[model samples]
Target: MLTRLELAKDWVRDAGNFLKENISSPLEITEKTRYDDLVTNFDKEVQEQLVSNILHHFPEDKILAEEDDEKIKFDPEIPHLWILDPIDGTTNFIVQKDNFAIMLAYYEFGVGKFGLILDVMKDKLYWCDSHKAFCNQKELESKKMSLDKSLLGVNSYMYRTNSGGLLDLSHQTLGVRIIGSAGISYGQLLEGKILGYFSNLQPWDYAAGSIIAEKIGFVTLTTSGEKPRFNCREQVFTAPAYLVSEIQKYIKS
Candidate 1:
């Protein structure tokens, strides 16, 4: 597990470097569902590299990736599964040329064994192994602070819905930030940069981050307060325990 985890880290870093090199290249962008939800050719290219790297070391592992293609498969008989979001913030990558991330999580029999999320622009790599969560060489501390006192990361759309009460909770925090990438947003949580993350994200978006969050004792749950399951597309919230409770106080669902 240690060897595979180390190799996963190296593979992702190399992938990030690939994205960095192509940032300035003339490119094409298309909307998957809407203009706000974008994908670039580089996204597909980087994912191919990631898959190739993983398969080189562990070809038997199943792969679940955002760019869904016939080439990857899910075989329950296989003990290892890798979930990937080759580029977590495509808009940021295309528009700002920064604040994007690469996320990958490896699971063993449905349980996340290790995860890695790299902030490509800043060269920050956040990962979780069997025992700990870290930003580079620094081990992260478990969640331990008041919700209102902690910096918060939230999706701005939460303010559009009155029933969730996320809008109200935002007012109670030190501040709210929307970094566009769930992987990067959760990385901030790992470093204590944000006290919590309140966003609607799918499994690939949150699975890797969840592995790190769980290790650090951070809570990953539904806004209505439910256990979050990985390897499936669903809405999820990863945050401190207190902040979750605070948000749930107003969440009608």
Candidate 2:
């Protein structure tokens, strides 16, 4: 019998392979909110496959996935839950054919146990299970970068809000990047390519990545500096603890 952790890892690998097999085919795409926010047939197909696979293997486990509107409101008191993002960078997958991910996280009684973020094109996977994080099996460490030295990610939508706090954080960081995918941005953070990521993200987008970041000593919290609540309607930010502290000053100032 596969241990729970082993089952999670196998599911991720199987899903990644499924994605790669279909990557080259023409996709049936549709707009979600706008032309920029897209949903592909593959996205739904993959989500269904993942949800089915997990449920079949672990009928008692709760699952929350991106394509479904039915939220799995598990008792935080429950021992096991699975969070999945079948295709994290759907825009990139549709237009650029690269930079998307299959992300998954496992939690035991509200505590994160494992995280997997797979870069489908690069064939690289980032993972952490209790002890350490690895990129393609090479162990990774999160280094603290000062605000001025940090590379920050801001959702393009935030640019429209004109919140002074957002503007100030953008100015303080070493640079700002608007990656179309939250999973990719979080993957960059895990690989130490970027110092911080701030966005108004949904649960599937952040759940898996947050687990990896927290396991490797990065901070995952809301703008209010509280632990993020999954399946909620609130926005959250994940970053290095020092950078988060620096950004919070702007929010208060």
Candidate 3:
């Protein structure tokens, strides 16, 4: 598993560089759920690269990716599965040209084995297993922090809605930040920049981060108590277990 994980890391980094090189190219973009929710040619190309690499090495592994409908849909019952987001923050990739990420994770019989989130512009990769996580070549180990003193990562639009009285909750934290990318936000959390990150995310958005959260004793849950399923589009939240209770409290109120 370690050897395979190392190889996968290399694959993701190479694919990231591929996308970066083409970042300036004129990309054919189209709207998905919203005008801002975009799918680009680079996204498709990068997804193809990852899917091909993984399938060539592990021919039978199930793959769930953002851009490819023809690829194998995720199957939780499958012995091995790879959940991938070729470009996690497509809006950032398209508009700001930064704060985007390429994310991938490996699950075996529903157990997370490895996860990686690569910050493309920053050139940092965060990967983890049950034992430890690393940023680039440096090992990462973090301590839990209280909400009052800890910064949080959340969607500003959701906070604007004050849905579940979240506006009030943000006031209790050190500060609230909206980075527009789950993978990047997860990286910040791992680096101790934030105590927790909450977002309404799909499986591709949160799968890799949730696995890392588990490995590092961070919390992963949904507002209504749904667990991460294969390819479900739903609201997702992850932080430390202690912080989750407060988030749920706010939602319930």
Candidate 4:
């Protein structure tokens, strides 16, 4: 698993560099479910490159990626699975050319073994295995802070709609941040910059980040305070275990 983790780290770094190199180049962008939910030519290209590399090195491992709808299956028979989000903050990538990330997670027999998230613009590689989480290869210590004393990350959609009482929840925090990228948000959490983050996120969006965060004492839960299912989208709340119940109180049914 450690060897595979190293290989994944290398692949994600390579992909991140590709994104950086092409930031100034022209890209063919298209909307997915909404105008703001975008994908670019680079997104597809990066996904293809990472997927091809994974298959080449680990042919038997199943792959689940954001760009390919056909491979979005959770097969119990596949002991090893790789999940990839080639460009996590597409809107930010298109507009700001920064704040985006590349995320990858590996699961063996339904247990998360390794996870990687590369903050492309900053060149920070946040990764974890079963035992520890690190940023740029430096281990992160566990952090615990009260909601009233720490900043929180809430997605724009949820904040705008006040979904699940998020507006009220924000009032309890020191402040709120909306990064628009789960991977980047997770990195902040791992670094103790934010207390927690909640958003309706897909598997690839939260999988890698959640794995890395959990290793450092965070727990990922559904809005209603259940473990999230990996097969579909869920309102995921990730934070230190001590803060889960307080955050869940504001999550309305």
lDDT of all predictions, in order shown?
A: 0.81, 0.79, 0.82, 0.88
Expressed as tens digits, the lDDT of each residue in 33-80 for candidate 2 is: 897789999999888888888889889988878788677764578788
Using TM-score, give the best candidate's number: 4
Question: TM-score rank, highest first?
Answer: 4, 3, 2, 1
Question: Candidate 1: worst 10 consecutive residues by lDDT?
Answer: 69-78
Error of 2 at 247 (Å): 2.3
Location of the lowest summed lDDT over 10 successive residues in candidate 4: 69-78
Over 99-130, each residue of candidate 1 has an lDDT whose tens digit, in order, gives 98999998887778988999998999999889
Candidate 4 per-residue lDDT, tens place, 160-240, comes to 788878888998988899898998999898899998888999989988988888888898888877877888888888889
Model 2 misplaced regions, further than 4 Å: none
Residues 133-179, candidate 3: write the lDDT tens digits.
88998888768687789888887766888754567778888888999
Q: Given candidate 3, what's the lDDT at residue 5?
A: 92
TM-score winner, 2 or 4: 4
Question: Which should have the higher lDDT, number 1 or number 4?
Answer: 4
Q: What's the distance in Å from true for residue 58, model 1?
A: 1.5
